[model samples]
Target: MNMKRNSVGDKVFDCFNLTGLFILVGLILYPLLFVAIASLSEPDQIYNAAFLLWPKGFQLESYRIVMENPDIWIGFVNTIVYTVSGTLISMILSVLGAYPLSRSDFKGRRFFSFFITFTIFFSAIGGMIPLYFVIDKLGMLNTMWSAILPGGVVVLNMIIIRSYFETKIPMEVQESAALDGCGNFRLLFSIILPLSKPVLAIMILFYFVHHWNAFFYALIFITEKDKYPLQLVLREILVNNNLNNLLPTMTDQNYLERLKQQQSLKYAAIVITTLPVLVLYPFVSKHFKEGLLVGSVKG
Candidate 1:
């Protein structure tokens, strides 16, 4: 066997790639680190540019202010409900939808797949006005369903999962299950699902993140303050900067403090909103990579 080493060109390319990767990692990590530090930092310190690498002055006032708001607590609960329920609905539907499409023996699978792909290329988001009318007709207006039902199964997620199932699973496995008298449901639950941990975990994460970060849907559908999601509450804080509801005792006396608080609150809100996903990512990220098993199975 000719066990020749990599050429000089390949060695140089590897070094170049590592350097690029290091730079890319720094580019991404620095901003995230800054957001976290800035959230814990004093807004005046940020304005002064005393330090950017770490919290210029560690302060919990912003977080305390944000947490003490009644609306924020209500919104947090509503958001948790929405994210968990929405992710469940989306994942189940996407997996079910993908299964039939993944089966090569299913007639017109290719045609149906093309239909799906075509929509991905051309699908436009429906206007909120028209969508509102439909939601109203369904009696979903001002309801959590208004947010969850409208986005039941994202087409792009379905497409990805269908591709995963189609290629990663072997036809031989299905045949063996059939020989063991396994019906479709049995084969799916007892076999495929058991084997699809990684993909399902990834799908759950994707759906969870999508629903958690969703604000526009809540903004249009939920009028009741208690029904608002965390993103909407954060939007109210960060964009509108309306802390009047939280502190009706606002006077010229403490006005400047409130203003300063809002600035820090913006960063704090971002950090608080993002913390769950950040904490969740490390657990699922390895599984997601395992799920994307390129060149691991035959068609």
Candidate 2:
């Protein structure tokens, strides 16, 4: 009877603990919710502070202005290009590098691994001028390959992938493949990569987010506004002193209305930038915990 009573008390405590955790999370996330709601609220009501939780007067004007800017669409396209291309490149290189590092029999493998790993600890702090000089020397400036080639592989992601391959892929299986006339490329593509879906998914998510949000590279290498990524375009609109790009067509009264509208649209643009990862993450989130743990383990 006492045990049963104790169990009941424990259950009640657990329930309250969960509820408190949720309330705490809600408190933290409220600002984001408020920003989202405020973005859609009416300009007059926003200025008046009449709306708190709900939008006082709903308006799509901010989005309309944001959409009207030609650069925004161009930047969106560029961002898509950069993200997709960069992610593919990152995955290919990381996979190739990690697969080799997973093997102990490869000649000078430890030396090679140390060589590759050396870049992670060091910081390169030179600005656009030095990078520009190097790119110019290579004659890659103003080219699409400029963006694609510079950051093709991320060292940290590669380390995670290599760890996963080392821990998860059995040495006996690889040895069997070797005996059966399977070469490095065939074993990697046909065996290793196929079984590394979880870690690969996590790497894809990481590289995708990195490439999508990258602006400094584009800002320096891409002189053409047509090549500007979405982040750069957003920076120009929000941080840089260039309001004319989005607000050029607005008249005096409409300009005031538009400026107010942009205040909300800025948040909406953030939501737009953030939306893809949110959508992609949930579908692959199940693998994240397993992949990250397995892929990053030492042994």
The digit string of per-residue lDDT tens for model 2 on 1-299 reads 45535588889999999999999998998877877777788767777784378877888777777778788888888889889989998899999888888888888899988888887776443666787888889998877667767778889999999999899989889999999999999999999989999999999999998898887777778888888789988888679647676655767767677767667767667666667777888877899887998789877
Q: How well is each residue in 1-299 modelled by candidate 1, as lDDT tens digits?
A: 99989999999999999999999999999888887888888878877774489888899988887778788888889999999999999998988888888887889998988887787777645677888898899999899999898877788778777777767777799889989899888988888888778878888888999999887877888899889999888888777876665545768888777676667778877888888998999988888666755412335
TM for every model, in the order presented, reads: 0.89, 0.87
Name the lDDT value of residue 70 in candidate 2: 85
Cα distance off (Å), candidate 2, residue 291: 1.3
Worst-scoring 10-residue span by lDDT in model 1: 290-299
Please list all clashing residue pairs in model 1, or write none if there are none.
none
Q: Please give the TM-score that candidate 1 achieves against the real structure.
A: 0.89
In candidate 1, stretches whose alpha carbon ends up further than 4 angstroms from where it belongs are 1-16, 124-126, 245-250, 253-256, 293-299
lDDT of 2 at 151: 78
